[model samples]
Target: MRLNAAPRLPWMLGLAGLIPFVATAAATWLAPIAWQVVAIRAFLGYAAVILSFLGGVQWGVAMCRERPGETPFRARMLLAMVPSLLAWPALLLHPLTGAWVLVAGFVLVRFHECSRDGRTQLPDWYQSLRTLLTLVVLACHGLVIWRLAGA
Candidate 1:
């Protein structure tokens, strides 16, 4: 699916959302030593929020696609909640550990969405956009992890 087919508003908003992740990741390296921890924390927090937001997206999709009592509906709803569950606890862990957790959450959510049944329910352009965004988000997480390790 071509990203050009996606609505302009959603596509632009999604790309704009990357600013926080990019800025925080860059700040980890560019900020003074005393402020690096602050940058890391902000990065972690933003990651958690985005992760949770992904879950909410899933939940919205499930609600729209599935009937209340269907077997797949229950499963989809349960799966939709997983990202938030992973993200909330991650906030309390060390920044390095939290980043790792967020990375895993993003990967798992994207993986699920790429499943055969998952693809059938969502628009092709959305999946394409998600793939692009997830790759960039993971790269930002990698940068933060590398910075943390070297500190």
Candidate 2:
């Protein structure tokens, strides 16, 4: 997909979202063993924050739909809250558990936005962007998990 397309803003923002994941993951790899826990905690915390932000975005999109009748107001509202709900507990848990929860949340949210059984959906370019972001985030989390396993 063209980078300069109408979805450029979201695409750029989505890519920018990787900064925290990459930075923390890199730090976890490079930092001393004693500092690794701190780095992982930061990574998971950042993931939870971003996940919450994404949920808000979903809520906004649903609320501002061009066709309000496409999805019932209550359903859209409930669906929109899912990410934040997931993210909150994630932050409270251990790093490993929180990372997994965020990863699952990302995958589920992407599916909710892109699937044919669409209630509230994103534009094609945006969906594609979300797919890319979700994959990268999941990979980063996988690395975190793997490192934790080997620790």
TM-scores, all candidates, are 0.95, 0.86
lDDT of 1 by residue, 25-133 (tens): 9999998988888999999999999999998887887899878888778878899899999999999998788889999999999989899766757877898788878
Instruction: Give the Cα error of residue 31 in candidate 1, in Å.
Output: 1.1
Question: Highest lDDT: which candidate?
Answer: 1
The local lDDT score (0 to 100) that residue 82 gets in candidate 1 is 96
Tell me the spans in candidate 2 whose CA falls farther than 4 Å from its real position: 1-6, 66-71, 117-121
Q: Which residue pairs in model 1 clash with each other?
A: none
Candidate 1 Cα outliers beyond 4 Å, as residue runs: none
Per-residue CA lDDT of model 2 for 26-89, tens digit only, reads 8788899878888898888888888888888777876876357655555666777999999989
- RMSD score of candidate 1 (Å): 1.2
